[model samples]
Target: MADVTHASNAPPAHLAAGTPPILELVNIAKYFPGVIANENVSLNVFPGEIHALLGENGAGKSTLMNVVTGLYQPDAGEIIIDGYGTTFPAPDAAIAAGIGMVHQHFRLVPRFTVAENLHLGWSETPRRLSGKDIEERASALSKKFGLPITPSAVVSSLSAGEQQRVEILRVLSRGARLLILDEPTAVLSPVEVGELFSALRRFRSEGGAVVIISHKLDEIMALADRVSVLRQGRLVGTHQTCDVTPDSLVTEMIGRPVTLATSYPRQSPAPAGGEAEPLSLKQVTVRDAAGVVRLDDVSLALRPGEVLGIAGVTGNGQPELAEVLTGLKAAESGTVYLNGKAANRADPAMFAHAGVGHVPEDRLKRALMPGLSVAENMALREYDRPPIGGRFSFSMAQARKFAQMLADRAGVKLPGTQVQIRGLSGGNQQRLVLEREIRIASHVLVASYPSRGLDIGAISAMRDMLARARDAGVAVVLMSEDLDEIFALSDRIAVLYAGRLMGVMDRADADRESIGALMSGRNLSEAA
Candidate 1:
């Protein structure tokens, strides 16, 4: 039990402020074909406040936001903006009402510069501002928001954090007074997250209201003035953040008390040199299609029963490392050894034959067949291996049974394996990937950003699965942009920056400040 003081049924304190709420939802209800997505949900957001919408996946947070942003029309209830009762039939109408949304996946043109991206979809005025004027205006907005982004930088060439800034700036440039951000910190490094928080605070100070949807308890506690919890499409409670604890929020969100400790084995790691390394890379260098070095002289060894966590910002060579390990890309130089066999020239098929399992970052594109049935997708890696199927024929019954067994072991709750894989929630999809990869990976497992979009419960379950694999003597490479994840799961943490390995250190030696400094481009020794 938690010692949290439950929120009152009355309207939030912000409603009592001198000004009218910037945005208000009154008895909002929405429905899908066979489900109620939101039921009688009401919220009040004041100017200069950050209101956090907390919920588990499928808990109706996104649905509620979609309704507010005019992506969906609620079956019941109404919206009020700046004390005016209104309805938005489309996103442009929502924008006209001074409401804007930044979705989890950004909507930026890849080849366009920041200024050009900002100019997109705009009805050019008769004044006809030059490119220089657009860049200057965008640059001023970036500095004003404390994002410090280059207005002339190409969207494709920018880091994840910078691209996120562009998204935020786009909304602000449209004269939005109320901003809605979904999972804003999902892809950011700690430093970038700090910058984002600063920007949010500045926005609030400038009388802009924000509604942020996130599952990160620490972030909600740190940044939000008030939090509203939802479960199963119903508003559970709305409380001042100062009055709640993380445990209380988790309980309200998931209907359970969760243990926060790492589930990985607590035993001392096996000596790196004493065992035959199952996966070893030595001075591996890789180049992109454009002839730019993506990975530079990186080297590491993964011992059986150990998890080597690679931590860095996105576009810092993590993708190249994953590609090299999974045989999706050949290294330009150096050696890759899998189960003590050289895999330098190996393609994905060769790596699969060598017992390498990969759970790619983008599950839909690289790992799972979205249109395929769950059972069929689950058996993708092992269909031709044995009794489940032969070289030419696969037993549907056997495949379903195998998938069910693995799903049960992985704690994946799916309605049926015959359903399309695309219908599963983010957490369940990742669970299916974990189930298949852990079962098929005999030599080594490589999981990139495995828990990126998952809620706390799903993250815990995924960590438990990885720990089980480690306990069963499988070598694991866990690459993530989240430092907390690295600290939780890795026996040793490897830092990557500018496509090079900064340093590798035991978990005991890894500290937030030092790792953050390394991630910000400080030399490892100097950071230490």
Candidate 2:
């Protein structure tokens, strides 16, 4: 794989004199079974720069990176690293060439300590290095980046934010010149993002180059020197970070204008009619497995035509509340009213019967049956809908038709209803969940991370569905860690800090300043 120095996709006359880019690609192309993942892609990563690889879902950003890391081989392309032309047979080859990648999911052994995990490439006496020596180096590296990670700390006991920081630190320990991170901030709270970016700045100071593939445009704009866009397997264009606006980036990736609009079609009765209350929770207190109180004396109500966004650091009892609401988990002490009806621990079956739909926060944990067929997954969501059953008998024919219609509505590209859901990508699986939950026209809806792994197009569709649910008078609670998502679709916001309810704010009152502070333990009007 020789570097194509005389490439013609762009002007060849001049590339200003400097150290050759740490990594370069020329006319790279990769193909999957039924899709062209990347086509004639050319990319360059300069040393000491954070290059944002920008693209929507299915835009080949991941694919291109996979090729670079040798997780997948491109059918046609040339890869040049630090002036050395080479072909890699596997990820170890990329690692050998001073390239390291930290996937969105940190690929670390949870049970291992920080030092032990990072030192897995070597034996106990490799190069006559002692355990104490490795631990010392690990400790020093953590301090260099101001990461505060302890070499002896167990990975399983650390928080998600801490784990992510350790992943970055592990890659740096390898002396890799080029680092690649995919959706690095998806799980972090806004404050954590700031901390993580600061560490990356330290890496930049040392002349390391970073190629970040992410969906959050604001973060990209904040940290990147230049942005490259991929659309439908092609390189749409590249934009200088200073010259491109959010609107232009969206246009480039989507190939059209996009409005942040949500619309759901249906005329379901609002939470209340002329003079009634839709749903209410009174004095709710939830405890975890360790007999720890999660929600403390919480009380709230949901009305028709309202989108209530729940924002907080994860593990702040939001999951408990969602479970209690959906009947997946019973509240320790609380009373729930469903459209003024007594909603007790009648099981999830009762929630479905009472026109309540739930999309759990963890898709694999509670939301989906991965081994089931796509049709079966869709059918399970609407077991109570007419034609399928009348609380008496189920109809297989109705289930199949309803499932197919929903499959299309949700934008899952399965070959047929019989296709196993696990075969679908994360984006399509999310769509399957959305369609099933939204199709029943329920009065109260609970959607947790509704657009969790979807691309831009899928996210737009989901936001539209939630807005449509609101417009049609469904009381909707959207639980999310992505504040941008909550900001865009929420009519009002509530902050959950630790195990307490902070306070509620209207859309006009919420911003990064207010929410970021709330997520952290700062002084605010709402106490938690």
Instruction: For candidate 2, write residues 144-251 as lDDT tens digits.
Output: 767878788889877778889888877776767889998888777667889989878778778888889887777888998777888887887765577789888888
Q: Number of clashes in model 2?
A: 3
Model 1 scores worst on lDDT over the 10 consecutive residues at 1-10
- After superposition, which runs of candidate 1 have C-alpha atoms over 4 Å from their true positions? 1-18, 33-36, 83-85, 124-147, 266-276, 289-292, 312-315, 368-409, 414-424, 502-528
The count of residue-pair clashes in candidate 1 stands at 0
Among all candidates shown, the one with the greatest lDDT: 1
lDDT of 1 by residue, 180-237 (tens): 9998988887888998999899998888999999988888899998899888898888
TM-score of 2: 0.81
Query: Each candidate: RMSD to true structure?
Result: 4.0, 5.0
Stretches > 4 Å off in candidate 2: 1-16, 121-137, 261-279, 312-315, 338-350, 362-404, 412-427, 451-456, 481-488, 504-528
What lDDT is obtained when candidate 1 is compared to the true structure? 0.84
